[model samples]
Target chain A: MNTKIENKLTPVRIIAFIFVALWLVIAMFPFIWTLWGSFKVQADFFSKADWSNAIFGFHTEKQTGGFFTMDGYYGSWIEEEFWRAVINTSIVVFFTVLISLTFGTLGGYALARSTYRYAFWILMAGLIFRAMPHMTLISGYLQPFFAWNVWGILPTTIIVLVAINQPFTLWMLHSFFLNIPKDLDESAMCDGCNRFQAFRYVIIPIMWPGVITTGLFSFLLAYNDFTVTSMLLSDENETMIPAIASFLGTVQEEGKVMYAVAAVVSATAPLFFFVLFFQRQIVSGLTAGAVKG
Target chain B: MKHSTFLLFSLPSLSVMFLFIAIPIVSVFIQSLHIEHKQVIIVTENCDPFGCETTTAVDTEASAKLKEKAPLGKFNGFKTYSNRMHFAFDEVGEAWKSSDSFTVFTKKLYNYPLYRALSFTLTYTFVVTPFVLFLGFLVAVGVNNLPKMFKGPTIFASLLPMIVTPLVGSLILFWMVDGDGVIGATLQKIFNDNSLSLKASPVLTWIMLMVYGIWHLMPFSFIVFYAGLQTVPQETIEAATIDGASKFQRIRHVVIPHLMPLAIFITLILLMDNFRVFEPIIGFRAEAHATSISWLIWNHLRESAYPLYNAAGATSMVTIFGVAILLLPVLIRTWRDFKEKNKG
Candidate 1:
């Protein structure tokens, strides 16, 4: 009771609350501003005599007809055909996650169950893979991809992303499998199920939580990746990240900064809702790596 | 499980890893030792006119056929790695011999693409890693002490920065720091300087990036540490309190030691991530003032007409070596942990 009382009014507690409140503001403020600013003209947001012109929609007459405008969204999505990039992003992300998870689960399960010395070495290799910057491997891909005429295609990029994500996906899922009791699978095998049968019929249902958590990470990687996509993809196959990046390069000269801003907001909106919906899974997935390590 | 089953299960991942990760690394190293084929030019002189003249021309047709025959380019045997854009060995030596002072020599060193990137990458990695850890730890403690009702929303808010796409997040911050944007204008107004721009200068850009690094990564550290905090023994805390230790003393002695492993885990991840820092630089369009190794590779690859694959390959090798060196401590720790676990 005395400790509980002390916790209520201690200077440390008060200071912590104040600091966290400030941090919360700093963390959430930029996205909110960007979201609102995306609905306005460049002049209103970035060229007015005062910054409040952004909030009040002052001097935005040419870009918008009213207090709120969808011109940026219209310009980005329709005029510039950002929808193609969106479709490309969605397709790549879907395939990358599917392929990565398929391989990651099998590999992770094998690594977790096997006692072979080779498995240890393989896991070590995965660690090295994790540490390697993707750009290094991309350099190798450029030549072979060009030679094979597979460069700048979605399938090639998807496969490469899956390979790149495998090390991390394997590591995370491996740890997740380790937490599951080995006996669960062993008993299934005792019941005359083969290893594959045991994995399919017995262990899989229980593994969904871990799989879903790992899947969230894979999705994030496939979705949020800019470096891999930008380098591997071409103009026809631009993903949203690279497409928006191209906007940043071209929009300034063309006076369409608002399109880039709108696209940024559009790209971020999914992630915003993603966090809101999947916060628990994300937190578990995130902490799972550190805790296991 | 049968050995065959294990092998079959792991084969797909193993194959992909080999095809992409392992083999590409080997290929990148090999590719770094080569350069594009250049046509041999012939010089001819004509003395039929009032004055003699000379003409030099590249034999393009022969060069094109040669390129098709050997598309990997001619092997230069590490010459590409030492060229001006890479290690710049010759230039560095000249600068060292000719420069009057250490500062001048250092300036000349930074003029080389490799060292310029190396300096900034190292500084960003070292500086951002510690600050992320510190801020994350602070936020974790703060949120841990908060009431349950506030914790969920606070965490949700904090996670936004980390969860959003890196390029998009950096762009959001970029807009805010634009010269006429809200935060930038407000800053100027407060400082009484209309011309001051955070995006215009190098030092300020680095600071903003560092701030972004902290903000973006803090939630990760906070989440991990908060989880670590929950598992800290309540009995130890009670014991410390009953022994009349002050709050700071108790925290320093008990809480920190308890969270040390998580701290180290966060540090390892941060170091690796920060070393490959590319997206923010791109999103910020900061190539003028700050360029990372990854950015250098991007620049080389983006040359549409004459993509410098050789230069990129060399830079990739250097970046890989840098990552290896930075990861040495963590690798040692991992090995030690594995040995101890095996022994136990």
Candidate 2:
């Protein structure tokens, strides 16, 4: 904690500081640029005369009689009905997180508590499953889903996402559960409680920290997913990420790229707030697997 | 835990994985062996106009019936795997025989879609992983040197790129680098070439995507390495410094060795992630220049008029094989570690 040695104004320290400053600009600039540009007309945002027009919004002033306009937001949200995609995204993310956590906790608890050889094999299988590219899995599901008449619905996508989420959820929670003392559940069982009861009463009450951390990740996976949600959901049941993508295809010919821009910013706003509120949990969740290994 | 109890506890998770993950892989393998049925054709002769005229037309109803009867189409039995869109065994052989030099042969092979995709995927994975590790370490060390007050805000700023959805993140960058956008305009002005466009060239597009990859992934490695730095033993660092080591020497010897395991962990994760790169290509609209294996399969299913399930299935099977091959060394190492732990 000594400031003199660590914070000395040496040449190396100055260079490192400049590098970090450069990285911060690179990391933060694009989002700030997009968010700013979303308010302007395409002419101003993509301003041919000068890039500074995007900053000052000269064409936006000429067109809309102001420096800022909500035309893009209105076009995307109201005209294109982006709200439906937002609602669909909420439902899918909510249920996917809930169901994945439920199944993950049970399986992870069993894996952590058991001493069988099969436990090792199961974890290994989960590792392999975790590495499977999601698009490849979606390719596998399309034919069967179409044949069964379950291809383009919210529930089917939710269930499929939960299944896809299992391997990661199990690994994370299994490691988390290993950190919890075994005696808590065992001592409860010794007091004449059965296994499920011990889990419900003894383990459940004290498992929130790990569960919350795992749940944040599950929430992120469901929220940020593009492949599964885009391919599996019907056009009518589109989520935000897919809807934003589809907007480009339809709006490009109509000269409405700003609508797509607005939608992209809208979709990212929730995740921005998510990181703001849950930075610690997100950081810990990322390092949990690495640290344990 | 008792076997029965363990089964009871894990039943819901296991059943879903079994029904969804495990079975679909099997189904994908089976579907790869079959291609869509050819359309039924009917030929007729009309004898009214001085000479008989023969006409051929597709029998839609019969083809529909065929599709209805066998939803998986005709069983072509591994033909789909060898077709021009996939592994392209025939094309590879032709290219091998005709080309006089190795480079010429590879250039010919790169024209095939699968090989083209494989080249990009492997290059992106290997190229991005190392940069992520190196730059991420620098950022971690830099952040660690800052006074405690500025650390939280800096970390918050750093997390935004990684935390945002990949497609959206790429799109944000893509727009800025578009011909009329900020960075693109600035570059054109600097280079004095109004015709210059990032999207117009293959090499530039590849670099742009890889740069985006490094930007998006660096934060994850940074956070992990930052955590690793917290546990770097102060005693070792102090001893090295006291033994006439410079600050760089102390970091190079003591700090780097302590963080080596974390670096390996990050590399494994970054490889797995970067190999499956798909969303950024779409977001950047870079498919014209670079296509990944995931994007290739997705294109097969979604871009065509009807889903090319057979082509997609074949690609998926191949991709799964690729993943297995990529993971083989790590799996073997893990297995050895497990065995050693058990023996000990």
Candidate 3:
């Protein structure tokens, strides 16, 4: 891909390399540092005497008779029951992704195929709905949910998350469906299949690539969400993010800041692997709107 | 597709959006017009040895019954919208009358909860959007110049800041900038000021939050711009070079105009996201110095004694209005584009 004008070691090339290298350090260093420090005692991680102690683990060694310790992990996972939150997160994320995709695929397909004005209006309305903050909607749901006796449960949260997720899900999947040929579905209908039958027999199989890409985003939204889950779910049903936040409150006062550190690192691990595996899908999904628009 | 077919296909998704999103906004408006039920007070008269005395006390059971009967509380019209915690019309009027200058008056106005949150939210939205665009463009250019072998790893690392949960990302930064943490400690040592702490200063806290915002948002913009760069057309670049144009001139005249549409898309998303900047404030514990509209609603709902549904509803309605105003320009632009496309 390189041409003669772009290949030379010019001043601009050097600057670009240096700038990217600096940004990489800024982006990745915090996670690496936190991951490393999670194993150390609070005294060492927040070393009063020397910053070098954090890297060397002097205080950790003195406290636990080793260079590394699992005290933070133990305290958060076992003593504090962070595993309950982990299980709760798994349930919420799984159901939210499943339901959002189910609803989004149907709606996105119809919007993509229809040439009607109302279809355009629906898409526009979805765009506006997408921009509403989660907290505002939660404020509305509180009184109603409380009155209905459906508040503070996993099912209610999953449904709300699925609804919040619908707008973006529809938009992304709509663009993806638009990229598919209309002839594929039309031909199936021509063969005496009904609309649903065509979508089931013809469109469903080929739609997996788009569905998978859209599902990755749906999964991320459900997993990374803090606002809806935090406010809607009861304390017993708290997910990982809110669990970590609550850790900050009680752990800090009890001089167990390392528990919060370990929890943060634990929460970040899945996302790290998420980017590693689904990097391509995430990139494509992010650019889908831009490219189409 | 026929109208019947479309309706059958889209009903489930549309129904949920209508029920949860559309209805809730209307509900938020309705709730904002009402305030919570006041406690039921009863007076008891007793004759003591010395004198007759009367005492007033709140009847908890009656209050509970009242709340249960009407969960929406008493209708108070638009009073909640103008209260001190919201638009604060009375407070603003007082400040306007007392102060001789605009800056002085604004300083007085900033003391109100709504104004303080609004100023920070607007400042953050305006400041962070542009910086994310500019820096994201630079990073995209830089990454584009890298060797093919290094691109994937560089992109992966860049995605980390953006991909992680916002609260977790901010907390990681918050810990580092704590008084005893590495960055914070090193700064103190370098400045020879042991008392220096990032969390203690309002200005530094705002800057820190903005830096966190940029860090968390820039990667999305970078990825979009990088994709746009891939389609910049090699023929055009070669033509610009052959025509004796410098790299900067070619980029200014050709490449930038190519990416303009993507820039608009990123800016719209960034503004919407930044306007709801709630998690970072909570993560960084920066509420003492700064707040946002979303955070104001959250604070009201998370009140110590009981959830102030009315107060939260009022703030939420204001926030919805803010979002509507912010999206109006883009909505108008999109409508115009749709019309022109149809005509052509």
| Top-down DockQ ranking | 3, 2, 1
Between candidates 1 and 3, the one scoring higher on lDDT is 3
Q: What TM-score does the first chain of candidate 3 have? A: 0.97
Tens-place lDDT digits, model 2, residues A1-293: 58677667878778878988999999999989999999999998887679989999998999999989999999999999999999999999999999999999999999999999899999999989889999988988988788789988999999999999999999999999999999989999999999999999999999999999999999989999999999999999999999999998886653489999999999999999999999999999999999997
Whichever of 1 and 2 has more DockQ, that candidate is: 2
Where is the poorest 10-residue window by lDDT in model 2 chain A? A247-256
- What would the TM-scores of all predictions be? 0.96, 0.98, 0.98
Q: Individual DockQ of the candidates?
A: 0.74, 0.81, 0.81
Q: Once superposed on the true structure, which residue ranges of model 1 sit more than 4 Å away at CA? A: A1-7, A61-63, A253-255, B42-56
Residue-level lDDT of model 1, residues A123-239, one tens digit each, is 888988898877778888988888889989999999999999999999999999999999999998999998999999987889999988999999999999988899889998999
Interface RMSD of each candidate, angstroms, one decimal = 1.4, 1.0, 1.1
Which pairs in model 2 have colliding backbones?
none
Better of 1 and 3 by TM-score: 3
Give Cα-based local distance difference scores for all models: 0.89, 0.92, 0.93
- lDDT per residue (tens digit) for residues B1-344 in model 1: 56899899999999999999999998888888889898867788977759999998998888888889888789999898989999999999999999999999999998988898888888889999898888888888888777777789998999999988989999999888888778788898899898899878899988888888888888899899988999999999999999998988878999999999899889889988899888998888788788899989888888557888889999999998888888788778778887898899
Stretch of 10 with least lDDT, candidate 1 chain B:
B40-49
